[model samples]
Target chain A: MGNLNPIQILVDTVSVGGLYALTALGLGLIFSVMRLANFAHAELVTCAAYAVFALSGQPVAVAIVASVGTAMVLALATERLAFRPLRSADQTTMLIASFAVSMFIQKLLIFTVGSRPKPVDPLPILAQPIAIAGAQVSLLKLATILACIACLGALTYLLRRTSIGLHMRAAAEDFTMAQLVGVRANSVILAAFVLSGFLAAVVALLFVAQTGFVHPRLGVQIVLVGFVATVIGGLGSLPGAAAGGFLVGALATLLQALLPAELRPFREAFLFLIVILVLLFRPNGLWPAPGLKERV
Target chain B: MTAYAAAPHAIRPAERLSEIWRRSATLLVLIAAIALLALLAGQADAVLQRRVIFCLVNLVAVVGLYIFMGNSGVLNFSVVGFMAIGAYTSALLSMPAAMKGTFLPDLPLWLGAMQVPHMLALLTAGVVPALIALLVGFPIMRLSGIGAAIATLSLLFIAYIVLGNWDSLTGGQGSLMGLQTYVKLPVAAAVAGGAVAVAFWFQETRWGIALRASREDEVAARASGIRIPRVRLIAFVLGAFVAGVAGALFAHFQGTLRVENFYLDLTFLLMTMLVVGGSRSLTGAVAGTFAISLVTELLRQTEVGVTLPGAAVTLQTPAGLGDVALAGVMLVIILFRPNGISGGREIDEMWRRRAGRKHRKLPEERNA
Candidate 1:
């Protein structure tokens, strides 16, 4: 085995972290507004991947458009169907319902499109190796980093500079108060779901491009990591969620590189251990939403 | 103040005694229902008997889950993880020394050579996971709501990774076979009955009441001097204990063990059972288990084409139909009847209300 390259490790960590950040943002946005930890977000990613897979023969732009469209529709549908009825229910109920929705979609996918993984190449150009400063990097890694940065920058501008974004921030801070101040709860929530769906679609496209395969469970692990990040960032804090995502990705990469080869397979266990420890120290999260403090 | 308290105290013991009786009756009702099923299973074919036993096993796990989730109102995703620990622990201790040496040669010398009686191994299975929960719960029970939920989910993933990769003791991805097949209908039913009683007794305790109060309103519970985390931790460990025992029962029932058996599929199924029956009461837990078990069994049988007695039509369903149907049923229940089939109330509560109504009606007729 060759010696580990620091720059290469940095690139891999950022690439993985970028995907997780997008997923975390999606989860965090919905949670901030509705107080629901939406497990069905996994299905959003899975649907997008499947959409891309089914449209693999089409141009890359078309596949992207179709996948994004499918994810947004599914997200909006689940919100309208399963979640709306239980909108006033407690957090646990909504969470379990989301899991049901997640499982429901996964099984539906399996029924419709077989359980076996199907290989597809939507953007084969991204798979090529590129050298940067004495280290080998895939074009996919660079694209992933750039895409993540662009998404993050655009999201920041939307939240800070846009009126609807201001309303969203207000809702996250206090939904009742925001509604009292003339924010339309339904439209704001719909906007959150649409954006979440958009993020899931982006992650799905990148994930499929990297792995070259699509399966019913392509999103479960990603969602799990995203969920942990959401928790670590503070339940309803968006920037905190993104940071937690990068933190997890970086920690995982470091563990993989630093631990002895025999212990490498246990990296996920260690990463989760650290997550539990973070909760122990910061039970509310690194950046707890301000509204949570009012509860006590 | 003393005189005012004394007046109520005079009537309190009687009220408490009746309360105890009522609660015991609820447990008796649950046990009797399980016993009836066990009796029916005894008279059935081997396959049917095994299926009923599995339902009883699921009851144990669900009731264990209900101990924490039902009372604390926190979602715990680590139930299956503790089950995995319990299954592997029991499998290791109960397997013959020679077989352990052959398959799990990397186990510690003492563990590799150990071959305990089945009952003792089963008890140890429950104890081991309880100890782990005691350790893990200290950190986990501190967080509330989604924070605690995600922490527990991480715990589940951690357990999966470790159990699946630990080559020596668990045989890695390979199945561990040749365990004593001691969990029959009687055993599973008895254990499940014991679990129900344990859950009921705990729920009636001061700690359980306090935990539930906190679940209703954190600030109010704290105002009443409840140490929320302490009670939550107590329930978490106890729940883990019961779940662990359930896992051991499952291993012995099947006479085989694999890491995959304790992962997402089992987690999803058990969660469905808990949520469908209602996650807030012991009765709901038992009802949910039986209900989903019946539903899944019916759906699975349909997959092979169930034939109607008088009709010429046979219902043919595709494979994996049961899961899809189960998910759909769970979603509908969560949406339309969020409190679950039991409406989150115990069976005795319904009985009491009906009895009270009958008594009231008699007085009304006399007055008329």
Candidate 2:
């Protein structure tokens, strides 16, 4: 392994890790209330990415608003049309439904836009390399880190201060009990979807900026990484999801920097091995929500 | 004779076997009919024969899924992973020595020197993956529901990474070509039928019943002294063996195997087929496979369309339409009939229902 600067690696970790953190946050939010791990969240990110690319000729502000709006609408519609009907269904059933929905959207995009990746240099400014203490960093990475913090900060504020947030927290804690005590289930669930959708849209935009292209099959890796992060942090815990995301992202990028060139391709394999070890030790995850035991 | 028609005096072992046969008669007949139909089609058109054979091979794999996911009520995502192992094993064992030398130069000396008969390779193919499953399926089966899903998914990832990167043995993401094509229509039919019989037999076993009990409710199964993990593991290994056999058949059918063929796409398709037919019954596995296969073939045909009344109009079917259609159908089935088209009931059960009898909800779920 060649020596890499510690500062550069840290920057890489924070930037990449922040995207994963946002992804895990969305998953954790939806899971907290519905107890359904939304497999379609990643697909939603792809949708937003495509949205931005489709609106390339438009002003950046218009594109951002459109892409974010598209993701939120799609999220809400899926919630209303697909998931809401299966609200009381078994976890597996809902999980499978989400899988079907995700695949359906992905395949639809492939058919419509073609599966090939298309170059999308939407924001040249975000891509410029900035020298940080004699280390080069992409402006997008720094922006991603900032965006992640802002989203998390906003979520905390909403969960702590607002009535809707209080209702959401209650529902997450005990869905039936919250409803029994008069928390409006519909609005709270909808809000969760909207918030998560926003996060996905944000992730999608950043992903496009970093990758410089949009492919029909993109976002799967992102979603899977996010999912692993969520599980590692604590499946149902919000803070845990973010922490897990950041930690896993950091570890991944660090591995990329540190691994021998010949062994670089197997980095994911090494990462998964560590994840399996962690689960064996702490099956409930690193930061499990209080009082929740694996019943099965 | 129906199980209902059996002597009511005592549940003798001989009579129980007869009753079991009777209960599964409808499903067995349907499978036999499919075989007969395949043979008949093979007489008429060559391409149709090939398609039917491919579908039958897939049917065997889906049935394997039912044994594990259906019985234990846990979805095993690493099924296609096991199939990859089986396929590679079979491919390596039976490939012409010269081709093996060329394709997989890094193979061990003895293995590279050896060239087994197709029959022997097929048998070994089933055994190897099953043995692997026996050794490694424990920590996975210990977790249930979401935990199991994640674990098995990770298992799939691990398997893909290993198999994909193990260039020495698996041809390193390239096609492992020049394998013998020993799978014929009759052979595929026989394998598929045997798979159906094996799954049905397994479900009648005590372990299968216990696993199903655990599926309905875990605490109660434990209270009744059912060792959930052991039973689930047994089902898992057993399922992997059958899936391995299916994989071996798949390798022989394809004649050239690729690592990319056995991953997320097929894994999810197998799962969808299992879920669509109903994950609860053997008939569900068979029905789901055939139904989805038919839908897919029909959609693929649309990629070369039929002339309409107004004009010789043919809609240009886009890429991945078949998968899209299938996923849409799965979503509809999940929303409307979450248990699947069979609702966990077997074909014979439907016959029994039509014979003027009330259906028995699975006993454990009755009180709930």
Candidate 3:
């Protein structure tokens, strides 16, 4: 097993982490602006995967557009109906509401599409593979990494440059002050949700392309992973969430490779142990928002 | 000092009556319903009785939630983790030798050899989870509000991964079987009743008051010389113990345990029960458990047909449809009455109030 190719594991690590980073970024963006962790972000990703699967015969670009659009709509509706009302309420209410929205959306999908796992065909672009660094890397993985970087770059540009992004930043910093400065909190929040939904679509495509199937429970695992990444990066920091995603992704892969054969199956558990340790020492997270005192 | 002494005299009669009703009626109904359910269980079929017992098991879990959410105002997303610990621990301890040999060959020699009695094993299960909670709570309790929620959620993921992979102890993805089915309807009901009664007693105690004080205003509680972290730690540990006991009961009742059975989905259901019942009251805990459990059962049992102009649509429900429906209804209730059905009162307080009124009249007549 030690003689087995290291390159394959490395490739798997990067691809897995890249997918996680993509989804975690979307969740982080919403958290940054809205200060509410969108539990339904996972379902948004699931919704995207289903959208792609439903549009299988279409052109790849068309399928991608439809998936992203569907996710955006779902995000918008979730924000308007579930989260918007609770935003003014306490944090616990919002958190519970997000869970409800998550369940509702998942069940709705199950009711419509059935609970069985559905086979998904990878887009034509992902069908090819390229040899790199003494290993075979699939086009799907390479594209996932490239697409994630592109999304990251685009998000960075938007948050650092665009007016809407500025309003989002302001709102995240202080909602009351942002409102005082004439930033429409609701619109900015909606934008955050839309952006998150778009990210989820990208991740869903990548995940389904790799796994070749989609299920109602797919979002549960990803949501948990995304949440851990969000905590590792910094609860409300976009870059931190991305970094955390890749970090956990890489950690998970490494543990899978390095753990004794008997312990290999507990890779995710090992990663969570690391998270618990980080949380213990750095309770504020790895990159806590500056100038914010502990609320307690 | 003189002005402060006159405060009780200034209290209005109407305000006092409203306070009494707020705290007592909710508990009265809860106790009466429990008694009614217990009585019905004697006459009910095996299947229906099992469902009632399931509700009772859930009552234990929600009682744990009431301690943390009700008293501390913190949303714990990992009650299922403690429940998992409890379930797995009890299942492993009480599993028969033949079953242990097949799935848990790698278990430590002593654990594999030991076949502890069911009741003792269940107690051990509860203690193990409590100990884990104590260790986990030290740092986690520092996180307030949303941060605590996230941290505990991580704990849930961690627990799931461990339970699923620790094949030696937990039997991995396979079901752990051969445990004695000792948690019958009577035992479950009694445990549930005892748990609710214990919670009520705790709520009126000094530690409970301190925890509530911390929930209301951490800074104020700290200034008042309350050790906030210590208070939260105790609440968390106790909550985990209760959840563990519930898990133990759950394992014995079902006669098998699976790791997947106690994950985020179960956590969501438990949270719904707490929110729907009212996080603040012990009665709310029981109420939420019964309401959500019964509603879930009804939804799964009820069949619906919709006739349209040219077509008919029929829906065949699955086992846990009621849980999902109750979750939906509770979401609406949470939006409106976030405090829950009873506003955080217990069942015993109702009878106590009536009895207190009669006693008060006798004392006044004797004094006159």
Candidate 4:
């Protein structure tokens, strides 16, 4: 702890935090209106990662386009086929359908491409660490942080100033009431998912850049982390989801760096203990919407 | 949407008792049918006997899932977390003294120097996870709906990480081995039968009714004097107890404790079983476990190679065919029967509908 540089750790924390927060924001977008925690988000992220790997040796710009495009298509397709039919189903039922879609897609990928982890080249030059002030940060880390900021900015602007954003806000508050009041249900849901898909692609690209590998299971841990962060942030609250994601990401990184060496291996256990404490303090999550009181 | 109407205010005690008995009797028949399957498997082949035992173990876990998820109407994704805790606890306490000496040198003298009998270890396994669930439920149960599900998921991750990395305790990532293969078809079938009976009985009790009422409408249940969190906590602990027993049975049945087995893959498998079979009743849990296990068995055989009945030609099957087929079937079930195969009704209830003693009412107004 004494030798650790505070600035370096901050950068590390934010980079990881940004990745998680971005993923959570994507998930929160869909969940806000539809109460469905799409397990297929994992698939969408994996689709993006594989796109990058499949397009290796291409220009970075081309690879990014491929990754983002694949995620958007898969996200849109699954929403149309699996989830749309279950639109009026129970949240649990919709959640299960998402799981089935996830499993089906995962197996399909495994069968079609083989279940091996392929090393991804996210541009070798971009892999190098660059010094800023007294701290060193990898180009990938810098990119992830910047991408998160830009995407978050764009998302905020869209939500605040756009007509679709107004519809989305109304829909999230009370989807049925919003529809009853003449909000076009399909377009709002569609826009939320499309933006969500784009954010997922962003998360996937940053994650694959950091790890330099892509596999069918590539997005499992990230999705898990982001899901928890979204929960901790508060369901149906965009700002809460973002805050929760950053908190989890930072806490996770901080725990690893701060713990004594012998306890490092069990860092996750400690993190979980903290999560339990947080739940105890704020059962509806840290930023639960004031109007949505806990009933059960 | 219509306001959720309140349930009828009163029912006679005699009527309640008879209703309970009817539900219990139907579940007993389901158990007996499974027992018959176990007997037939034992007579067929040794491999089938072991496979049947595995199915029974899975039955216990899936029923464990139903106990909380069905009654509470909360989709819990953390039963395997309790299972892992139970299995690891049993493995450590039940390991032979000599092996424990070598494998877990850091184990304190008391736990390492002794090897408890299997039954005692199993009971301890059940109790430990129950207590852990109670502790976890203190916080997690306070949150309802999606928040509750996600918080419980954190518990699962915590259990997995601790079990995977605590090398001296768990052998750290390597499989925990040397567990006695003591769980036979008869033993597992008996335990599973007891699990069904326990679940059925629990659902009839005051706590169970209160929890189910809360599931239907938390505000109405609360208004009627149900302590929502307390009822949920009771179900959580009770469900963890069953999961713990299943975990003990699994460790003995599989002869090893691989932490990875208790993670997401198994969690999803058991949950799918619950959902497809119907997450609301013991019949669904039992039927789902049986159906999925049978399909998996068939798939496993063909996953190597299959020969045509008349033609001599052999066909190579792909790996993960079972998972693919099972998931596909689950999707179909969700599409056609969103309430599950049993449609959340008990066996006797289904029989009543078939006999035309009860007419089908409109489904709860939900989006399709």
Candidate 4 local distance difference test against the native: 0.83
lDDT of each residue in B1-368, candidate 1, tens digit only: 11112122344767656656765787889999999999998999998888999999999999888999999999999999999999999999899989888788899998888889988998999999999999999867878777777888888889999999999879989999888899998899999999998898888788887887787788898998999989999999999999999999999999999999998878889999998998877889999999999998898899989889998999889998788999999999999887788877778666866677432122113433
lDDT tens readout by residue for model 3, B317-359:
6544554576578678867777677655455444555466532
Better of 3 and 4 by lDDT: 4
Residue A50, candidate 3: C-alpha displacement in angstroms: 0.4
Which is the better candidate, 2 or 3, if ranked by lDDT? 2
Choose the strongest candidate by DockQ.
1
Report per-candidate DockQ. Answer: 0.78, 0.61, 0.52, 0.56
Tell me the spans in candidate 4 whose CA falls farther than 4 Å from its real position.
A1-3, A290-296, B1-21, B358-368
Q: List the residue pairs that clash in candidate 4.
A: A88-B367
TM-score of chain A of each: 0.98, 0.96, 0.94, 0.95
Going through the candidates in order, what fraction of the true interface contacts does each contain?
0.82, 0.60, 0.59, 0.65
User: Which tens-of-lDDT digit does each residue in B252-279 have in candidate 2?
Assistant: 8988888789988898789888888888
**Quick one: best lDDT, which candidate?**
1
Give the Cα error of residue B229 in candidate 1, in Å. Answer: 1.5
Candidate 3: misplaced stretches above 4 Å?
A1-13, A291-296, B1-32, B303-323, B346-368
- Candidate 3 chain B — worst ten consecutive residues by lDDT sum? B1-10
Tell me the spans in candidate 1 whose CA falls farther than 4 Å from its real position.
Answer: A294-296, B1-16, B357-368
lDDT of 4 by residue, A1-296 (tens): 43467778888888889998999888888998888988889889999999989888899899999999999999889888888898987676787788888888887888778889988877677788988777777887888899899999999999999999999999888887889998998999899888888998999888888888899988777887788787778777899999998998888888888888888988777766776677778765688754455234
